[model samples]
Target: MQIVTEKLLNLGVDEDKEINESQLVLLDVKEDEKSEWKALSLNKQLSDARAELFVLLNGVEDKEIQDKIIFNYKALQKFRKKENDKELIVEKEVQIQTHERGDVTIYCDGGCTPNPGKAGSGIAVYRNDKLSELWYGLYEEMGTNNTAELGALYESLLLAKKESENGNTVEIKCDSMYSINCIKTWAISWEKKGWTKKGGEIKNLEIIKLSYHLYNSIKKDITLSHIKAHAGFEGNELADRMTMYTIQEKSESFVKYDKEIIVVDILKMRA
Candidate 1:
């Protein structure tokens, strides 16, 4: 649980850190059916903890460290499941490949101060590991952190499209799992469901739609990867700094293209 606490702290989830960490450390038991329910709930908590740990450790290049983490994760998964449940199976192994020459990488981040207030997004595009372009902008109106994140991705995709025209593969690196999930995975289900979630209305539906469309329109190969925020990745760190700058300075001059200018205008209008 200390590891969980440390990971949450690294992720900037400070508000519930102490409480969640304490919950993991302490447990109450009673001899009744309610205790069975409590056990199930505790299992859920353990599963969540294991998932967070996996996310934090993902994309690690050290084979020894990756194997150890995977072993622990699989053990925890097995321990948490009921006897009647199917056994956990390793699906496909994930091999993290280093960015290759001629690969175009885009590192993007977005955030807001005081949630739903003063939101902004930033992007850093790299060509063959060299910084090619940088952009950041403030939303004209208040928006959630996810919106800012998606905005960064939207802009990055646009840049990727341009770069891909020269026959380079595009890889997008971002810290927002929500935004990544929306485009890469959940959008397929949402499309099948007529753009509705079972829980209710989907947030930022229009932006999601536009982003999904843009992603498919690009003819070149595109890859999306989630990176841990503020974790010393140079491009990601630069994007994060740009987001902070936009939030604090309220300036828009960092962006360079008329197309980008039009995109920001559309984002503000949609927002």
Candidate 2:
């Protein structure tokens, strides 16, 4: 029977007794016989896999291969739900409530023109309501917006992971939901697929890989979220500003300090 390509890949099929998406499931199959499984219609195949996908057809369909997957449909739905979950509103240099616990916040962003052309990145941190530190770099040549964004995020998180002398928990934030999702869920597959979606020319492979490594460096669970762009959000606005700062070579605005405390605002997006 046909299975969703993603589902097949995710289930690690063929590892041992692995077969299909539904193979590892404990679902009480309506049928137990292999013949019954073979005779099942296609929808049941997805259902068996416990896929969160939905029907996308113009008419009531029948064939197993009639529908196309809405890539990232589940991720977007989950993202929207998270956005509505009491708004993890991360603000700028707003003294974190975690100072007593000694945890700091990090923000990162990046950009480039003609994508594979000139690139730039920025990283900032806040502690106890002040700009504890900032990092900005320029890519006179090479890379794209997505690459630069991943670069900025990776370097920033690296800084946070390194600064934790006591092995304190740190939080890193960014506005690119795709970046967050890819790092959290798709990094391995992307790596195995050569950083390309289907083993093609992965535009941002290097930086994406770097970001993945940085994410894994955290001793505690990582948290990432999307911040509204151009909605007068301070943390996001600064992240954008920091990114443009590198591209424009205006490196004077960034700061550096020790000791910080504030809710992490993961703000960064490219226009």
Candidate 3:
């Protein structure tokens, strides 16, 4: 998904050297100041780019690479447009309070059917290894698995903060390594870089930033771990099941799962 920018075409621009060669360039100035090279409205430009790329390659043969390229290109467009300004004003903030002397574990998951449709997130919370609460929702008509995963993780962080305030040490388990890395690993560097990445635009930056903020605020009492999905981890399996419940029921808000949890029955519910 490499693009040709003005710096690549021009002779001298030391600063442009830092830009990745494979970066997606939405627009660049033409030879004259008043003219532009490939300017179009963001959506129209992106549609054309995707069409041209797929045509060049003959078809969408490699889905992973195709998804990555399109995801980063769209992210770059959002970055350029400063589209998340209103979204950055998050209403929720972590508050520090005295602890209550308990321990809790939270398992969270998210998924989408058909890759880009009917996405939702789910969470299973346990107190001292005993099932205590279940949560699911954040439904989207058209959303990626990554967004759903991040949404679940963000909600888990909120619950973890609450548990931490209750004097409990909290552990959060998630199967998506990408989401975990975005919050616990890469976010530190991304924050320092003003939320821009040298490799490309940061995908899901808004939620990642919010999750990172909440995680850091309560990190002293909370631990985040990555686990294998559908590998006989009961909590993870339960959380995974929760994701489907919302999509099945067409729920949009992040709400509690009030039904009783018979492990085998709940597992079979999804089957």
Candidate 4:
């Protein structure tokens, strides 16, 4: 508990203030009566509580602290379920046509406003000459720019895997050399070394592993290319805009995909 508290302090959170505030909000929730719990108000409370929980969850490395955080998270999840609130849930899987023709290109970007502050990730997918999908979401807690960038790459590959058939080429464009090299080169050595580099623990190991697996799972010609960020590339520019929009507005999980035309909705993740 002390370690987790210190970690939260290092992340610029006032422990007493934040926890007290969250407790007050949780206490206000009417657990028995659904009629008194307005959707909007309950959502705001859940979001705030989740945000605090994420900060604590992300900051700590100890399993004990993680278990404590998960306990709190489960309580929040239970309350949210009782209220039938689905706004904060995110879809973990998506289905798309596997035989779509032509090449698919994905542009991805991610960053935090203050680099180590609230972070977000965005991706834009183009099939042949038409835009196919757009996705962006805010990180629940504070995170580094690289974490968000790696998340973008991971999500892009995940989408490509779901949307493309075998033998179809998929191109991923991003500006982060660190993220690009991690999957393309560094990850191999890291895995051989038990997920380490220079005998030191690797940062963003979870996302890096996820990205590596997703990259390898695609049985197609997958190309990762670096583009000059903030330059005039159309897809890159839109991805950047979407990333910034998420960070600035703290956008919820949003996904828009082309089905005949573009369709978007707030989705929930399946357990």
Q: What tens digits encode model 2's per-residue C-alpha lDDT throughout 81-195?
A: 5664334222212323333445567777776766767777776666655556556664546667776677767766656655454344566767777677768888878777656
Which candidate ranks first by lDDT, i.e. highest? 3
* Candidate 3 vs 4: which has more TM-score: 3
Using alpha carbons, what is the TM-score of model 3?
Answer: 0.63
Name the better of 2 and 3 by lDDT: 3
Candidate 3, which segments miss by more than 4 Å at Cα?
Answer: 1-101
* Per-model tally of clashing residue pairs: 0, 9, 4, 0
Q: Against the true structure, candidate 1 has what lDDT?
A: 0.64
> Candidate 4 clash total?
0
Model 4 segments more than 4 A misplaced: 1-95, 98-100, 249-254, 257-271
Model 2 clash tally? 9
Candidate 3 lDDT = 0.73
Clash pairs, candidate 2, are: 95-129, 96-261, 96-262, 127-260, 127-261, 128-261, 132-257, 173-266, 174-266
Root mean square deviation (Cα) for candidate 4: 12.3
- The collision pairs in model 1 are none
Q: Kindly report which residue pairs in candidate 4 clash with one another.
A: none
lDDT of 3 by residue, 1-271 (tens): 3344343323222333321212223233333432333242122323345434433332334557656766776778668545443332231222223323477899999999969999999999887788877788889999989999999999999888877777788899999999999988899988898988898888888999999999889888889999999999889999998999978866666777767777788789677
Q: Per-residue CA lDDT of candidate 1, range 91-140, in tens?
A: 10110122234888899999887697788888877778886556777453
True-structure RMSD, every candidate: 21.9, 19.1, 15.7, 12.3
